[model samples]
Target: MKFLVDAQLPVRLARFLESAGYDTIHTKDLPHKNATSDTEINSISIRDNRIVITKDSDFLNSFLTIKEPYKLLLITTGNINNLELEAIFAANLQFLSELFVSHSYIEMTRDSIIVHY
Candidate 1:
């Protein structure tokens, strides 16, 4: 699976995904890092056929309209740092990947993961 880590996530998560053998891109590492907006990120995901990983609620609106994203993984833990966010994903990689592979939007909280097809 291909993934585009949004600005809210640490670029390191992209490295982790790459290590897991999935294609991944970190927006912070791009040439126009500071210039890229959420819309641009979504557009890139659409063009490259990649799933978007974000903590931003704006994506929820975009997904509602475009619905072209392969999948969306929205982390709802709130204002947490990158390390904590990474830990959450690491702890639930299997379950989360399954949701993505099924091409669904998943809202993950501390105790539960809700999938919307």
Candidate 2:
């Protein structure tokens, strides 16, 4: 699976995914860097077939209203440190990859992963 990590997420998350053998890119890699707009990110996600990994509810709104970004992994694990966040992904990355194969919108919370049909 491929990923487009958003501005609110740390670049290390992207690096973690890359190290896990998934193709990944963080917003900082873009020309506009973290300033890259949600619309543009959505466009890139669709064009490149990347699943957006974000904490932004705007992408959730767009996904529900217009199905943009191709797929989404919404992080709802509020206020955790970056290392904790990475640990979550580390423990769940393989399952997450499998979930996305059959799901378009998935939510990751502190202790659970929810798959939305």
Angstrom error at residue 55, model 1: 1.1
Model 2 per-residue lDDT tens digits across residues 1-117? 899999999999999899999999999999999999999999999999999999999999999999998999999999999899999999999899888988999999999999988
Stretches of candidate 2 off by over 4 Å are none
Best by lDDT: 2
Show the colliding residue pairs in model 2. Answer: none
**Each model's lDDT:** 0.80, 0.96
Query: Per-prediction TM-score, please?
Result: 0.85, 0.98
Judging by TM-score against the true structure, name the best candidate. 2
Question: Candidate 1 clashing pairs?
Answer: none
Please write out the lDDT profile of model 1 over residues 33-62, one tens digit for every residue.
Answer: 846887778788888888888888888888
Q: What's the C-alpha lDDT at position 111 in model 1?
A: 63
Clashes of 2: 0
